[model samples]
Target: MSGADRIAAGGVTAHENNRPPKIEIHGIERIFLKKNETNGAQESFVALKDVNLKVESGEFVTVVGPSGCGKSTLLFLLSGLASPSRGEILINGDKVTGPALNCGIVLQGYALFPWRSVRKNIEFGLELKSVPKKERKEISDYYINLVDLTGFENHYPYQLSGGMQQRVAIARVLAYDPDVLLMDEPFAAVDAQTRETMQDELLNIWEKTQKTIVLVTHNIEEAIGLADRVAVMSRNPGTIRDVVPVNLPRPRRIGGVRNTPDFQILSHHIWELLQDKGSRGGSGAQSAAVPRVDIGEHIRDDAVI
Candidate 1:
């Protein structure tokens, strides 16, 4: 069986055995008080409501939605950078009370220190944990190689391309050995080809490390390409509209998978879901038949916010 099949089967077995999920978001609702420009009065804006999800250990889940649908807000809550007005987030059966060391986040901007070299950037987290210099070097070396940045260890962020810098950001996160990785549009800044390369690299990393990852993206192809399941969210008081499973065979290549009948069908299905303004509280089928039209044209037309 393919590695992806094993992961899918293992997840099912884990659930049947009543094992607690690796991460759980229960009844999450986040409210933000914003100043109204005209009135200069504070108004409560509901960014997220009734958000709930459970991620099994070693699963890769992607979230896609229109802009302002609280995708990033969900990651913030998961990372404990912010708290929900209602609901609780739990990791390994423990409620998250504050920033968690076991959770590492990567943002769109790369967030690498311009002054720090690749090695230094990857070791920053270990430094915080007071890992010994020798041990830190060992760990950083492993991750630098893992991300295929071994030769650029002494290079600073400015010296590398956007994609390379993003790799450094990922390596830095992985260096900390976080059980869960939360990525917020980590590859959105790179070119399309580079983004595809990064997606394949990430799948390889996930296969080797078995880390549970939840990534937020505005690209539907990206969302479906990298995920074991895609969580489609809705806005205007944001909520998850559907959780769509990607059953394409495991160890997938982004380019190859896009050409498959299943991939096109899945992309069209997700596109239709996003286009439906009134869609709420529905689950996607395991498989569906969709016309062989170019899904990209539709994506470009509506632009999967």
Candidate 2:
């Protein structure tokens, strides 16, 4: 949340105006231990602390931070995969207490079954829910095409490339048609070129499906390039530092967006915040402010309750 101004990348491009958020989070916290990471006395780790955020429906929100920060912790909480020790999360005005079917997730690696073909993998969710074969086929085929894997529908996970497998993973989620998409470093395993392609495909799917999205990544550029709003978090016992709106325009392609003036400005601003944290000797107890200069050139202020 440092500088919200123009970036230096290929000269930052101006972004659109900020809008109200769709998903709301308040005073959330999560604690974990190896149960064995420490044998003598399972050492406890507080991964998240008082993380508050709001993501508007259909908005693309990206969470970025250093390793061990609670980015993934927050994602898990939102999807109801993990329970929080404290706080509340609301989706469509209802508080979340457990896993809900409407939330689709695409984690860091492809978790598809090796024995299943692309189409069957996509249909798996439906099968569990008792969706009939005809409807399952319809939904699965639709998503396969949506992810541009129509011709590869019969291919098994072993036959597809890493990138291709990811496509199928996405298609499976698309078939689920979750209103909110939760992705944890979904492209971290792919090479740079393939990563870019996956990012592009993500945008297309998002635009077409209009699903609310929350992506967790350690990459700052990726955060700025894909998110409508980038939420920065502090280290362990993590808390959100800031939520900066990306004003970059639409129909934006990946490479072009990265080189924009706005991207450079925001990237530097965020970089500065990270640097300052190091300089200031960041502890888990960081200030509520995420570093950022607003679009109006006015700085943002906060007081975490």
Candidate 3:
């Protein structure tokens, strides 16, 4: 067998010697065909393959993989925006097909509409679903306060800073009260300091809502901090290679958790995995590259995972 093939086959055998399933993904696959307009040689690219992933409800799972690995593609399928070329995805006991109201998605750019004020933007979903205007206002206000964007409610998208915009975006989703939040690197566009703040804010929200969040990110640190489990994906035909459970006790404080032996061990293990993947040009992450997908195409321009 080829080296990659041997590793692929053996790695599963080695890793799955024992472990129970949580969220089962069966033979998921997708292909993107880029047409050569002039030459007319249809170049079909496989974005994902026979992939399997298991995530427990209420589990905060973050996925990291390589360039051209189809990370965003997989996420889109999970979010019900796109369908897999072949395969089935089940969350709890049901299959995902059309955009289900049960799943809320947050993109990196804070995709707030420029035409709407912060409050209106936050209320958009509820309004679309025909929620009573009064209840929509109430829920939007509650989540607006939750995200600490109360003062900015009157402001339009252009008036708010990137971080503030993201806060509003999050609140908008939270207002809808979906069972799962599928975030596509929601914090990637902000400045480093703001990113840190955003991370803390997300944790705070998670504590309150306990929403099952499945986030796609390139930031290992962010993944470590926010996720209950991290699923590392591989190159091309992206698939979960390792599912690391973050057993660290929560009500977590930053910097401090990074010092814990367990945290350090897990981080190191994931770091090593990234390195190995990089060495073989496998994907999880790397030093030279930002280690994420571009946000523009992803609905979150900074998906560096």
Candidate 4:
């Protein structure tokens, strides 16, 4: 086991606390073989190294890091779309052998079929399951309303905006009734205003569905605002540097929460951690303490945790 893995293993365990984790990633590593075009020499690139994590049932977790930090790779591992070269992943206490029905994934690209209408797209999964037409329509209608896309059901992907298309994608995933939702930068392509709205929408959906969600994004503010715990990762070998819990009250709106003193403190702390890791060449063996700084007056002193 790697030093980083050892540190992670010693952290709070769900089993130790008598609450089993809904999702557990144990000592995972992903390696890709790259061939040099000039000499045809093959080299092994370590995307992730001995990564460990645990998410309680219905918990919202976000993984954030610089590009090439393997945040998306870890999500892929969890979804069973890609297998780790080492370690094991478990969902609901069962080892993930392949892509299971309990997992639903939403990618950055909308991936909606251009030929299909919004309602039809949302019902695609149910169609695969051979659900009756009336039942499929019922499930699709429920998710459409949940996502606020009720009136746009007959519209096509190109007929809708980027945010709308993404909502359709999310509703389609929910229609499948997966126990967990794995989103890989689902709002990266949307505009700033739309992204914020989508974030709020996603949180509301999470609350309503109560499904365990794991999202990977490069945006620090998005990570902090949407997650109960934000897992900060280092580059190079792509090990998790730290997991910062968002202590802000729930029913949070980005406009309100982002301006809070507590939010600023945690944001700065995470920024420092990322910067420190970059300066140290992304070595997970050495852990550094995050320096807390007071932004200004009017913010709670106890906000810096």
- TM per candidate comes to 0.88, 0.84, 0.82, 0.86
Candidate that would win on TM-score? 1
Model 1 agreement with the true structure over 6-32: per-residue lDDT tens digits: 333443433444667999899999999
User: How big is the RMSD of model 2?
Assistant: 7.5
* Candidate 2 global lDDT: 0.75
Candidate 2 lowest-lDDT run of ten = 296-305
- Evaluated against the true structure, the overall lDDT of model 4 is 0.82
The number of clashing residue pairs in each candidate reads: 1, 27, 12, 0
The candidate with the higher TM-score, 2 or 4, is 4
Q: Report the number of backbone clashes for model 4.
A: 0
Task: Kindly report which residue stretches of model 2 are placed more than 4 angstroms away from their true locations once superposed.
Answer: 1-21, 35-39, 277-305
Cα lDDT tens digits for candidate 3, 1-305: 13323323432432353433334578898888988889989898777877777766666788865555677787788888998889988876678887888888887688899999999999999988999988888898898888888788889999999999889889989888898888987887889889888888888888888888888877667777787777776654466667666766678755557676666656655654554432433343433364333322332233222
* Whole-model lDDT, model 3: 0.73
Candidate 1: stretches off by over 4 Å: 1-17, 277-305
- Rank by TM-score, highest first: 1, 4, 2, 3
lDDT value, residue 3 of candidate 3: 32
Q: Comparing candidate 2 with candidate 4, which one achieves the higher lDDT?
A: 4
| Candidate with the larger TM-score of 1 and 3 | 1
Kindly report which residue pairs in candidate 4 clash with one another.
none
